[model samples]
Target: MMKFKVLFLLTIIGLVTCSVNAQRGVRIGYIDTEYILQNVPEYKEASSQLDKKVQQWKTEIETKLNAIEQKKKELDNESVLLTKELYDERYEDITFEEAEVLDYQQKRFGPEGDLMIQKRQLIEPIQDQIFAAVQEIAETKSYDFVFDKSADVVMLYSAERYDMSEQVLRTITRTSKRSQAKSKKERQELEDEEVVPVVSADKDERQQALEDRKASREEQLAAKREEREKAAEERKQAQQDLRDAKKKEAEERRQKVIDERNARSGSTSNEAKTVESDSTAKAKSIVKADSVKVQGTVKKDSVNSKMPKTAAEIAAEERAQKLKDREARQKELEARKQKIIDQRKKAREERERQVKKNDSIAKAKKNEDNN
Candidate 1:
């Protein structure tokens, strides 16, 4: 039968080729029926259901066969004690069971059996779909002849350009999609939906929509990253400004203390000079007044005049106290600045750590969603 088909195909090809020069050339195409069947969802589902039925039938047959075998074994074991008539009855029953099992197997698996009938029924609709698609394509594309590559007719060489399997599959898919609708209105809606291009496998609307969604998500992620970077930069700038402000305040305080120290030093120098001038004038007075009584009076007056030296000492003590106070204030200011810096540093680190945690969480969620 296969050789006959091949010979017929060759004859047709030769005739078509001979007529091409005298008439319009035949536009020939081929499709793989097997490929079409594999791609059809309804067909695959029906095939699965049919396979399950076949398995169940096989199991039933096996169970009956096992029962028959067990009965035979029992009959053999008990034959020595049984009477001839009883033994004959038992053997006859066993034979009947075996015959019944054979009939069941024939009924289930024979060429004209239920399995074949149901399988044919299941495939008839799919075959109709393929035929309808092929007819439509032939009419639309003005094909003179269309062949099934998966059929018994063997072709040693067929060009890929002449393969219409994908187009047929697409057409069948559209038909199945329409038929699946519960109502005429829904069917119409499905029919009105955009048809995928036959030549372009990547032109599926759902896949395109998925790619669009992916692109949108990536853009959103990029925007979020930009926002994070901007916020981090702003935070860093704020920290720097805070540090500058603290430094300026501390510098101002230090300069003020230095000015106060210089003022005190100048005043102390003036007081010392005044004390020295008074002592010199008093010495001159002591030399001028030479009597014992006058000399004693001068000594007492000079002692009274020496009070400025004590005042200068007091001024020196006050300057020392002020210097100590200034040093304490400076130390306190430095500590406060350092504390603020530390606090800000910790805050920035905490924020960055939290951002990282959030990023990790978001990434995990995204991965989960993808899975």
Candidate 2:
């Protein structure tokens, strides 16, 4: 009884395992981070402001670099005329000035460059807060996995249905607002850190205009070169392809002519055979007719010799016999001519049919060969 109970327990466990396996399945979702970042007003405002700030910093760095380069050029130009002592003194001065410039630049825009880094740092936490909310949503909704929709890896997806970015953005915006409202000191610190000495507004504008002009000229030159190269390559390829196509067409035409000549030759040979047979038949008939005439002439001569009669009677008999011989020869010639004409006609018709059949066969073979 104990063994039977154990076996029943094992069976119950197996059934339960199968039921659990059937019920278990994963739910997955996707989110478009870029869409969320762009559509959310707070994120849009922050991103635009950050871009402007970064551009300003980049322009300032460019101006500084240009100034340094110009100064170096000036030093090089002066070095040729100066005495060693004077040159050394001037070089020391320039070196000191460069060191000062570098120190100031590093202090202002080093690892702790401007308030932008701080702003990004602050904003990153807010993004993390949104990520946390997304995680919570996934867990609560029984989702096993969630993927970022803006990523390159997610090439195709259900557009509207897969996007949870809007909800995530809203959560982030609310969190950021509440966090800012709670921390006045941090906001003031951010504000204070944003103040930095920058180039004069007019000079900055003039420099930017110069840079834009230079960039535009470079772009135009590069584009013209690219266009010229592309046009040349296309022309070369087109000429090559034209040559290849012409060669192929010429080959096909030559093959077709060869096939047509073969068909004509075969038809001509068949017609020649028919004509030869008809000629032989007509020649045999002529020989048979000539033999019969010879026999009749011999028989007539013998009869004339055996039976002597009046001259008028003999003349009338000869005339009648000559007329009969003439009629017989004419009938034999007519029958031979008719037979030759009929044979010629049948040969012509057969040749025509054979030519047509050969042409059709040749065409089919040509098509098969081409394929």
Candidate 3:
């Protein structure tokens, strides 16, 4: 997550860097590599040679493979007529030929193969020459950076003023002329030959190449757009799923709370039934114990028939004991219920906080991607 934030910050910083480069009057120029390659005589010849060689190798490989297939077919067809020894020998011969053909293909076209070697050998030098020219021009002009407009860089807008393609082409022309000339007369002739008009074939090819590049860039942009739209749709779907899951969880939690409350109520009711039965038995025991007290009261009453002791005093004491016991039991039940409620409230609050945190993170990530 922190890495994503850093990447977002870096992207913003890159935009600012470009703006700062402009404000500071940094000398950044660009060139068309395609144009340069198109004009370079050596590169054109090397590319043509490479294409010819590749075609030749491809035809040779195909021919050998076809020969192997034909031989194997003949061996299979003649298998029933030939003796076991003869058939085995013919099979081995076909197998060897097939192996040889495959080996040849791999030598020419496999990983770390001759085709790749030939490509690097032919192309790398031309690329190095171009790079040297570009670097020399950059150093002499004190340019901050030289961008290749022909490559796969993406740009929404650009100005023509920063294009140094013509400048680079002129340098290449002069350099080529210098390398080809020996005397002053030839040098002068080449110098005078610099501004010849373009042939129609070359002009048409150049136009076609530029068009192809434009078409390719458009395809790439379209692909990128499709990918972005797909990603956004996926994110939206994911968020919706998360919301649904969260809602279902909340519902389950609510149902659980209700079930727990119902269970507690049922348990309390059962407890109250047991307590009532116990209280009735205790009341009968008290009645039985009161007979002795009444007998003693009768003896005392013989002396004084109208007793000063009142029934209200005994009633008040029994009422006071019952109230204290009832309050204690009520406090215990209330404490148990409150504890459950408090625990549930804490759990719910924590879950909500976590959901909010995750949502905030997702929003931040989405915002970053959009930017």
Candidate with best lDDT: 1
Question: How many angstroms is residue 247 displaced in model 2 relative to the true structure, after the best TM-score fit?
Answer: 39
lDDT string for model 2 (142-222, tens) is 556788766776455374644667667755665555567547876665545433333333564478799999999999999
lDDT of each: 0.77, 0.70, 0.74
TM-score of 1: 0.45
Q: Where is the poorest 10-residue window by lDDT in model 1?
A: 194-203
On the 0 to 100 scale, the lDDT of residue 99 in model 1 is: 96
Clashes of each: 0, 0, 0
Candidate 2 C-alpha error for residue 187, in Å: 26
Which residue pairs in model 1 clash with each other? none
- Scored against the true structure, residue 108 in model 1 reaches a CA lDDT of 88
What does each candidate score in C-alpha RMSD?
A: 20.3, 23.0, 25.6
Runs in model 1 with CA error above 4 Å? Answer: 1-24, 181-371
